[model samples]
Target: MDTLLSSIEMLARWDVMAALFIGSIGGVLVGAMPGVGAAVAIAIVLPVTFALEPIVGLTALLGIYGSSMFGGAIPAILVNTPGTPVNALTTYDGYPMTQRGEARRALSLAYSASFYGAVFSIVALMLLAPFLAKVAPMFGAREIFLAALLGIVLVIVTHRGQVLPAAILACLGIFLQTIGIESTAYTQRFTFGQPWLQSGVDLIVVVLGLFAISQALVLLMGRDKANDLPPVAKIGFFSQMKDLWLYRRVATVASSFGVICGMIPGVGEFMSQFMSYAYAQRSSKTPELFGKGNPEGIVASEAANNSVPAAAMIPLLALGIPGEELTAMMLAVFYVHNVIPGPQLFTQHMDFIYALYLCLFLLNVIVVAFLFFATRTLMKVMLIPNRFLGIMILTFSLIGVYTLRNSMTDVAIASAFGFFGFILKRLDLPTSPIILGIVLGKLMEDRLRTAMARVREPLDFIDRPIAFILFLMIVLAIAGQVWTVVKSRPNRKGTSHD
Candidate 1:
């Protein structure tokens, strides 16, 4: 109660209120714009968070993270373009609905589904967080090291079709992070002789380059096309709200998938949304209608994706491990503010946790309300030229990187990464694993080194029961990946013979 009261006092400030308002609305705007993903938007602003008060800065970022998906559906439903990468699944059902003149209903259903997901994940976080705090400390350095290994392994295998590319990129990220002088031995591994390399790579600079700058290049290089908005009908919000109960089963299941994926390191909205959509399709009596404007499809995708932002924080806040790329960036903000997340955070900063939960809950409601009333206005945002938006994002990226240290070297580094990011996009490879590798690489190294001081044997790393279980899970995951590849060989061989 005291913590809640303290948080309430802290949140009453005007700057916090402004942060919530601007971040939510801005998130929606950027999300509505095609090719401008939430990750890019967050990356552009990550440097600015360093200068603001911790609470104020965090609240603003949280607001953006929480609401962007709601805006993401706008372009998906109307323009058949996904505003954010994760909204790609939403396009399968949303765009078809728009073409059939049910645009309003599709948007409404998407929003309602998002609400169901957002609320469920928030409640789960509230209920599970304290319990997580209690359990976080039971695992030691070896367990954490194993957990980080599991995260890296999961990042590779979860790419499904692009497993090899993801592994290579993850290794590249780990290697990049190891470039500077060693934290323990003080010996440089990859610097070669450059003064800039001595300090190693900056996470923000890398993020700005790979995501923000690279995305800008893609946008600028690509020609923009104008899109026509489908006409929307007037629909009562309350009527649409009541219609959601019919999908409670699917909504509940999808939301559960979101929370579960959000909690596990490396499994993100992509997995949750895909699994939910697949399940919904498999279970529906009218499965044929799934890709053809099915309301259930919208629910499955939106609910699961929206649930992720809050649930992804579970591992971040409880264990200091990021569940996805976005959370990895958010972890940077936590570090900048000197607000470390983990078990000790609960005992030391319970108020911040409670406040953050409340803030997410309210921001969600505000986003739904704002998006509901501004539906007509938002569809118009889709017509803005992608090239112009790309230029603006590039400008923002350069400025943000420059301000970090007022250094030209950082700007150049970011530009190089930007080109790399563009190449990844061109080659159709995942960029997220690299970020994960960078963030988790440092973590795994530190934990492993700490654990090795006492235990040197390979088998000794899994002596703890929890560590053993995690190691087993990692083994099973690898075996499963191999089996999947091996099992597909027979089909290919038989087809060749035929």
Candidate 2:
């Protein structure tokens, strides 16, 4: 009770409120742009924050971090483009829903779920910071490998009927990741003597190509125009609140997974999103509805991704660890303020800690409020002409992919992948597992190599209890999926579902 009072009192200050308002708006716009994420937003504002008090600066940055995940879904829903790479899963159902003229429903579900997930993580962070921090170090290379493996398995399961094609694309993605020089051998495997390929492919470039650019090509070839889009429903701001209430369990489980995964250093939003979506599909009665405009899919992906931002702070606040790039940037700000985050931070800067939590909570509220009121206007995006929108998206794709590395080679890669993605789409192949593979493959390979190097025997990595349990879980998941296919064979015999 005392803690709550102090936090509320601290958050009521004028400077903090002002900063949060501005930061939340800035974050939404930044996140709505493809390729611009929270890290970039924070970096842009960090310079200005140097003149303000530590609390104010930190509050603003937290606002950006908290709201960006929800904002990323805006583009994913209205267009077939993901503003942030983590929003790729959101695109699976979000864009399909948009095509069905359920943009309002999709946006509302994303907003509500994001707010709920952010709040859940904040509460968890307030209560379990120390405990989670202590447990975080237990996740070494072996555990990380398991987490990556689980993600791959779940993604494969997401495409139940197209498992073979998805697995092939996934393998291709992994092969693409191996294009650069081999780490241990110091020799190139697929670079083919090209100096540009030595650095490997960038995730952002691939994401833009896969979702944004390929989508533009489809729009160009299609007969439909943007103005031909279905009219937005006249549902009020809270009309979809019932759907959110109905899926409370999905939100809770995904949020819990987010917090748990986020607490581990270097495990970012992708793992949580993949794991939560897989879990939601595994448990859902209408599992077939996923990837075809299901609200639950949006809820699961948005909630899990949003939950990660706050839970990510747990390790940063409690153990002085930066879980990912965004937290690493926050660490720089903390050091500038002479605020060392460790065991002493809680005792020495209790007010700041409480204030930070309060600010994060309020940031979510501010973003939700802004989005709710502005949703109708945002949905008007669907009314734009497809030709113009396609051109704009193509331009955005080119610029975003190029700016990430400023290399002509990267631009070429984006164009090539854009074509490849379109071909896969025509073939009815799932591109998501490929993107997932590209994202997780490097981490998996690096971790497994490190764990193997340290252990004398191959099985030593699985000797630990955590690793052993994860291995069993993987086996069970695979077996369960196989059984599901075998059992459904009778039903699918004549229909030939794929």
Candidate 3:
């Protein structure tokens, strides 16, 4: 009760409220653009956060995180191009609904589901984070090592069809993450006599390269013709509310899945949205209508994507382990304020922590209200020419990458990754697992080494129940991949019979 009261009191302050408002607007703009995601947006703004009060910094970042989820849905509904990968599932139903003259209904369903999912996850974060914090300290080197392994396995398994390519990319990402000076041994793995490489590749540069610059190159190559979006009709809020209530069960299930997936490390919003969409398809009465404007599909995708920002914070706040790249950046913000996350954060910085809860609650309300009023204008951005959008993305990617360290070397790195990203996209490879691996690699390596060093025999590290369980999961994931590949192979006997 006291914590809640303190948070409410802190939120009533003007600076925090102003930060939230500005951050919300910025988040929406960034998210509406092709290829710009919340991670890139937050990364570009990280240096600015270093100058602000801890509460203010957190409030701003939270606004960006929450609003970006809804913002991504805008492009998906209007243009059939998802602004972020998390919104990819939204396009499966949202764009089709727009083509069917149900644009207003689709947009409305997305907004409502996003609003509800965000608010529900925030509530869960507030209620559960403190208890989880208390339990986190009990996790030692062995447990942490196993948890990291589980995260890697989850990413590989979730990629499904392209598991081998994903695994290769993941290995490459892990190798890249080891380029910087080692925290434990102070040994540099791949600095190669370059002073700039010693600090390693910036997360912002990599994300901008992979998502923004790569997308711009693709758009530019295909800019010979212009593509336009359908006209969206204005619909009443009550009508949209009716639609939402009609598909309440789907929304609930998707939101639940989002919270669960978000709580796990490495498996973030995209997986949640994908899983929810699949689950909805399997259970829907009108499953065949899913890609043809089904309201249930919209509910599943939007709810799951929006729920992730709040729930993804669970691991970060409780265990100092980020569930995804965005939350990992948020951890950097926490460090800037001289506030360490994990078990000590709650007891040491109670007011700031609780205030974050309040900020998240208010952010959802503000984004929904803002979107309701600006839907008409926001939807029009989708009609912009691909060429112009490409130029804008390139400009921002340059600016965003440069802003990270004001170094030309970072820009060069961005270009390199951009080229690699374009090739991966053309090949139908999954990039999410690679990003996940890069984000978790250092932590996984450190924990594994620490756990091994604690035992007389390295294999004895798996004697713990947690380690054994995680090892079994890794085995299962590999087996599942093998089975899938075997099943997909053509049998000579069957081919002859045919």
TM-scores for the candidates: 0.96, 0.61, 0.87
lDDT ranking from best to worst?
A: 1, 3, 2
Best by lDDT: 1
TM-score of 3: 0.87
Rate residue 366 of model 1 by lDDT: 85
**Clashes (N, CA, C under 3 Å) per candidate:** 0, 1, 0
Off-target runs (Cα >4 Å) in candidate 3 are: 224-239, 278-285, 335-338, 346-352, 490-498
Per residue, candidate 3 scores C-alpha lDDT tens digits across 364-480 of 888888887787887665556677877877887788777767889999999998888888888878665656677667668877787777799767877877677768877887788
- Candidate 1 lDDT: 0.89
On residues 366-461, what C-alpha lDDT tens digit does candidate 2 reach at each position?
Answer: 888888877556545444455665676677778766665578888899888889878886887777666667656765787788788778986887
Candidate 2, residue 74: how far the Cα is off, in Å: 9.6
